[model samples]
Target: MRRYLLCTVLFFTMISCVVNRTVVAKPILFDAEREQLTLEYMRDRYGLETSSSAIDPKMIVLHWTVIPTMEESYKAFYEAKLPNWRPDLENVSGLNVSSQFLIDQDGTIYQLLPETTMARHVIGLNHCAIGVENVGGGEGLPLTRKQLKSNVWLVKYLKEKYDIDYVIGHYEYTNFEGHELWLEKDSAYRTVKTDPGEHFMKKVRKATRKLEFKLVPEK
Candidate 1:
């Protein structure tokens, strides 16, 4: 009887370890100030009107900043408010641009926000998607292999934590079409956006497929 009890305890201990390892912990970059302000911006700028229980994420969207460095991109996204450069951006402030994660050209992953909070990266889908921004997409700083690998790791991590159904590129967000989650207040808000292009998203999807995530349909 003692030997049987010992075996049962060992089995449970192994199961606990597996659960712990698979669970995605909140990324370290989550700033309380930024999180609170982001939620407020979502309410005021996008008119999302979310309650504490409303922010259940269902997809992960990938993007590129077009900026040269990760630090610059981080600074741009870290501000509590929006910027004026994108004055044409109808959503209150350009500061509404944010993602939960940022992957650098060299392949370093920077967690800019937590997975549970809403980031203003994608219009219509911000309430149900987690955005991941990749640094550098211009001629001088192209996306690299390292960034691709890091994206795979990050996608897998998020899938393990949330009930994530789709892993999509920013450009493909429109493909959701009639899905209930594709909602935004302004019709003009659905402007054309192509970032972290098709090639990059294809790589991310192929890598993440090994982990069993469904790829967002190509538009």
Candidate 2:
């Protein structure tokens, strides 16, 4: 009887650790303007006429902020309007690029927006994909081992909560171009991406192999 009780307690403890992973809530400027812009983006870009900016996430797209520090990364996504520097993206939409989550180099996870909301990180799959941006991916600031572990944890946590089918790198977004999940209206709007590199993605996938995420479609 005592052995059984100990086993039960251990199981509950494991569950608690999984559920209580630290995720700091550092929400960006998802104000009224951002919400409206998000709705417009969905309608104009993806051809989905939804009143709310909420999304039904089918996949998680991982990214890396080329910017070096956590503060800079946060500031980049703080504004509702796209910055002038990002003229290429600004031409496409006024809605600034943002992600649902951002992980610092030290592996601190910040929730920039709700997981089930649309973020402009991925070009074609934003409507149904959750974005996770990691700080510092430049030549000098490669992603750390801690970030990789945190990403794996985040992926598992999100997968458990949502019906997520695929965990893809930002670069892999284009592979789903012709799949039903692809929703961009303009064929010429695609951009080449190589954030949160293939090595990082392979680690995340191997760590969560038991989740059985679907492989990325052939490009």
Candidate 3:
């Protein structure tokens, strides 16, 4: 009986270690210029003129890089200015696109920036959304099962750390357009997204349904 109890305790301990694994730090450029650009974006796009770039997160947004590798995705978000390749976003602000956390294909999580700092990921909800971007989701580079497990762990971790109320995919951001959480000033500036596809989100939502996160608002 003693041996059986010890074995059960060990098994649960191992499981806890895997679920609460440490996130690897792979920070992007977040100099004074980037901070200024972030503030400018908040003021211009969301009509939120604040002195600091800090945000009180209320939602978590999951995304797929569409870029093949972690290194390439990191480079894309390295600088403060929008790259020439992303002309569609340049009109909005010079601040380059980024997220607070980035997950590699192997389930390794990276913290690109501070958790509460605002990142320009989801439209209309940047003011209060924390973004988690997975390394691949384009062509042959589909997101791996390891990445899904990592995302679930990450969502639970963030929910525990913050007062998070909702978890939504990048593709579902538009559904909150007129909801109280929506704050974009330019209605015409919306862009259609199909990232971290429906199947992926359904699995994540199902796994995290016990958290009691609010449902996505109807469009």
Stretches > 4 Å off in candidate 1: 1-48, 90-95, 215-219
The segments of candidate 2 whose C-alpha lies over 4 angstroms from its true place after superposition are 1-19
Top-TM-score candidate index: 3
Q: Kindly provide the TM-score of model 2 when superposed on the true structure, using C-alpha atoms.
A: 0.92
Task: Give lDDT tens digits, candidate 3, residues 35-112.
Answer: 999999999988887999999999999999999889999999889889999998888899999999999999999999
Off by over 4 Å in 3: 1-10
lDDT of each: 0.73, 0.92, 0.92
Model 1, backbone clash pairs (residues 3+ apart or across chains), number: 1
lDDT of 2 at 69: 94
List the lowest-lDDT window of 10 residues for candidate 2.
14-23
The Cα error of candidate 2 at residue 142, in Å, is 0.5
Clash pairs (backbone) in predicted model 2: none
